[model samples]
Target: MNVEIPYFARHQLSPGGTWISSRQKSLRTFKLADIGEGITECEIIRWAVKEQSAVQSFDPLCEVQSDKASVEITSPYDGVIKQFLVGEGEVAKVGQGLCLIEVAEDDTTHVESTETTGQSPVKTPVQVTHDVAEDTPTEAPPSVNVPLRKHPLDPTNDLSGTATTDHVLATPSVRHFARQHGVDLAAIAPGSGRDGRVEKKDVEAFISKVPVPDEVETASRQQEDVVVDLGRTRHGMWKAMVQSLEIPQFGYSTSLDLTRIHGLLPTLNAHIPAHFLPSASTPSSPRISHMVNPSALYPVPQPPSVPESGRFTKMTYLPFLLKTLAISMMEWPLFRASITPAPAQDTNKPTLTIRPTADLTLALSTPTGLYTPTIPSAQSFSLHALASRVTHLAYLGRQVPCGLTVKDMPRRGGTISVSNVGAIGKGEGASPVLVPGGGVAIVAIGRAKWVWDVSDEFYRPNDDGMEGERRLKIDVSWSVDHRVVEGAELAAFVETWRGWVENPERLIAVAT
Candidate 1:
């Protein structure tokens, strides 16, 4: 069945939710909620529904681009999509309405509330209405009722139970989000929103200062484990990274003489220009701030021999590689699919084959675990467009927005991934593990070095025909989904990438 997903709407929904109390009717619009723990707003990039299309409650309704990721906004209530208040690339603040949906009237309704003090009100009893499913395991209410703000000294009170457990069972990213929100792990209660999942809302009401109920910790030997939280971007990456590990892994890499990228640097600099080479310490700048200032703080001068390629293009090589990957993935749709929901009817369990209109949810790691700021489509995105996205996300990683709602990455669609370790000098073989939900591939780019080849190689200039040749040796590792991508095709993919670097113009065709 073809479902119509309109990018925009010509009308708003009539306020009739009050009348649909007894029907399986559609209701008013519901905006995108807090999907990540630290995310404050997101740009609506695509709509999965139009003004009048029936949608399943959990069906992907819209794709949202947060500072952390580009994820589909699932319908919180099942109904017909009645209207759209936001459009593609339009930034919507947290809790802003994005669309309306009419739902089947049921005994259940969303109960919103908040705590009374400098603590979370997470344990406020919520009527659980959802059951665990592969797509949405821990379902929540339509909207969380945020308590009207209160003060510690305010004479307001509720008998809301306090959070008692310090170590809650949640993904590392969720744990971090709880901390970022000032959710005290010691207060409130743990209710697995799905299959007993203590979801984001449960954590929101939890606080570290809540008194321990009945001294449960003193009764058990508590092993010490420092919890690290993976935020939305990291959670997404964790899901994808795991998918890549279960497959047969392979890697093929070759340095693009870099001669052309190096060559193009001079011209590109004359037209645009760059500040410096990017590194771990590079400060991502607008993306990551807090670094020394070039004018006042550093008191440094541009190196006289700084080549434009090294100064500008060199800064963007890996991202271009990602663009190169996006082109390949578009040509090979199998790479972006998840393999869990196989067709039992087929001889070979058919993995889910997807052709994403956008592949911008790629993530990188940080101290907090993993994070990704949405990058635009790789195929037609300009270098500036790509660079700007990378820079912004890199900084957001450091900024760590508070009060953002985050959930554990459910095992699902992971197109592909890259892990770069080449900046220091030499490549090292890495066993990047699979993140526990879903994902099929991860590429680890190792160090770089020059090798000497002694022979009258016809591939070189005549002046160096009989001399020892210096060629850069680069290591590339590919982690694949054994469920779908096989070793041979995986090798071919890497080989094709290798060939592109071997001949830089090959990249231009894709770049243009």
Candidate 2:
């Protein structure tokens, strides 16, 4: 019953003399490369290469999203994509094989000796329980109509019945079966199946055991359950937050009298450099004319080094606050110090590394996640220069696509972090967390609210009875690691900060 087959068809066969194609073709697994510093994993945003499609070296294969930004991965060899190990919308660890590429004998530059010697590496097929089929036809090309299986961790994955607080491990078929019978998968207990994956039989058995509910009863049963898997950035935040729980922290709260600083803002804003201002300026803007007349407000000195572009034009309390914070840290050296465990050579005692300059981390909240961009050597920059840098960093953080990169968050981030909680709302105080690697001390700046002062009694005689004037004051809450800093030193440190905050003119002197 042997029938003569065509030469092309014979070459495609898996057995007999047709093994030449198999011998010449080699499968190489391409692993994910390190896209950014400190990034452990990334989510596959999209696949550029299709299964069995020919691709040249350096061609874009896929796009992966890291905490910093979305990056494209390219091919290293001239080959055809065999299969994707980690599907789109799924998280893949750094250094894990992303996909298998089938390379021709002549094209594989440095393929393993085993692969080139007619012996192919054995690969076990990954078990796919999802609705989407993993296998693609070897002969047929990829089709646009083919629907991809929605990843279990995908945020947009639809929920049919009551959304489960926990992830339901049922297969697509089981889920479909449950849906048809109006069965809620979340109510069923985990089955005795492998990895506790709920089988179709498990769903059926559960449905059979439960009594049927009326339409009214089903309608009245509110489904309040929701399930959301944390993205890479958010997950990292969670881990960092959990690590902070191990540190012994203490809090100190005080108010910053912004009476003088507030009055100085109008003058500082007028002196902002033209280079930092927006391109479309207001025709009658007084700020523009005052740029040339910098002598009026004590010329806003240019920074030692300015970024290619500065985003801040108008000065605010933040730039002043940052300036003073940096100055205070410089005066009190301990505030600029971080305690580290003993080096490997000397395991008996711990070590303290005190930075010469004050590196400040500004806690900025973004849509993606919380980022603390470091302003290295904040004391080195003038008030105007520091304001520009802070504005630039904030601009990067607030970009629609998030322009913040790994360089923005230096590895040796400051020994202190500042969270301007007051800028957002009327919060009186906040107990900010001292992130493990972030710093030893963190401060939360609350909104400046007008408060009546009664200190006039001390200055004036008891008989002179004069009502105290209203002063705009802000609350500054401090959280410090108890292991490194003592209460008295922290209080004394706060007193020094208070002195600078109360008299912000000292900041200009210090900066000069």
Candidate 3:
């Protein structure tokens, strides 16, 4: 009897009389999944896998740039890439097809038509991987043929003869370093780094050992200027700064005495709670009680413990300044207010939305870019807790591609922003700019220095009575939205802040 064979099972008989079943290849389009925080689209920065290349599940596919962060997209299927629907430097919307993958189908039940569902092929939910180009290691590009040249150190001319460094393994940062120094990576082949990877030290060593000829040095100096595109972060800043011009702002400059805080810093550092110390594994130290105390009566409260991200061995004046600012913010409601636009019906009647809690934004400069991460409800936190939070925020900012997320930066930013320019330079004064929605005001704190105060109001006559007392002071400049905050109000607010700063003991009195 003759029987009909299944489509998948149908096979051809070889010359050896052996039946062979053919594996059919089906085309499937891999779509871009939704990356969080209401992001609609992302720019394809770089592709990790090439077209027609085979990839395994969980293999990195491409890196995309969003407004907030850079995320690495990974493949969800084990297949060969058939075609790239979207190229690098192009923006792809969510749910859009990224590439066509060719998957093998062996059984009739598993066979699928060559059609796309227009949905992400990722089996599991998409997750954001913040591995920037610098952090992610990738294979070198194709090598280029170059004319042979002799090296002073290598008499055989084998080590630094040709510029075939395209195959040399190095990170994007190391490559940038080589470019900046005008050194060919191929000349420094067989890098001393692990697994023959080129490192910054390797580039430095190459620069130190390889002496450049006067002719070549002159040619390098006369090289053509190269046009470079601004990164996503810098581009965003450019737009924000442009928009800031529409807002009316006024600048206020003043100096604060920090001698008292400087004197108190050593005591504060020495008395940092054990729980907040980085070396402390446990929350609290063991305490022995001479007499038994009831849970209801004479109850001893446990001290707050610091998270790993917020742990610190020593304290600085910045935290004290932040705490004092929070107190001043609580006292002055206008500083804690955000401007809300008027309703559609009433275009002229805008309102100020005063937040009950004191939210503070800190201007942090990272390798990636400038980020203003907020510390919500700063008034509720004690001095130690405030310091821990600041430490945690800074740690997040320092990470590669930056660890700061939407959580670190909320929709409604801090009503007031602070930038510690003093940490970097010795500038005594600055004219800080204020951007719309950046809060009502922004302050730049400059370096602290000792200055002789001739005013009799602050200092009393010493034993000599001939010279004035020396005071440690720091310069602070404020730029406030003049549309909302009057110049007098800004001065009055600064004076109120000075009260808390001058008498930091009040912070300890009201410690949580």
Tens-place lDDT digits, model 2, residues 173-202? 465568768777777746656655677788
Off by over 4 Å in 3: 1-30, 33-68, 71-224, 280-305
Better model by TM-score: candidate 2 vs candidate 3: 3
Global Cα RMSD, each model: 17.6, 14.6, 13.6
TM-score top scorer: 3
lDDT of each: 0.51, 0.72, 0.76
CA shift at 367, candidate 2, in angstroms? 1.0
C-alpha TM-score for every candidate: 0.45, 0.59, 0.62
Pitting candidate 1 against candidate 2, the one with the higher lDDT is 2
Residue 154 in model 1: lDDT: 18
Per-residue lDDT of model 1, residues 186-208, tens digit only: 44345555434456667755544
Q: Show model 1 residue runs off by greater than 4 Å.
A: 1-155, 158-257, 273-314, 336-340, 343-348, 356-363, 372-376, 401-414, 434-439, 453-466, 507-512
- Candidate 1 — what's its lDDT? 0.51
Give the per-residue Cα lDDT of candidate 2 at 39: 70
Candidate 3's error at 49, in angstroms? 23
Give the lowest summed-lDDT range of ten residues in model 1: 2-11
Ranking by lDDT: 3, 2, 1
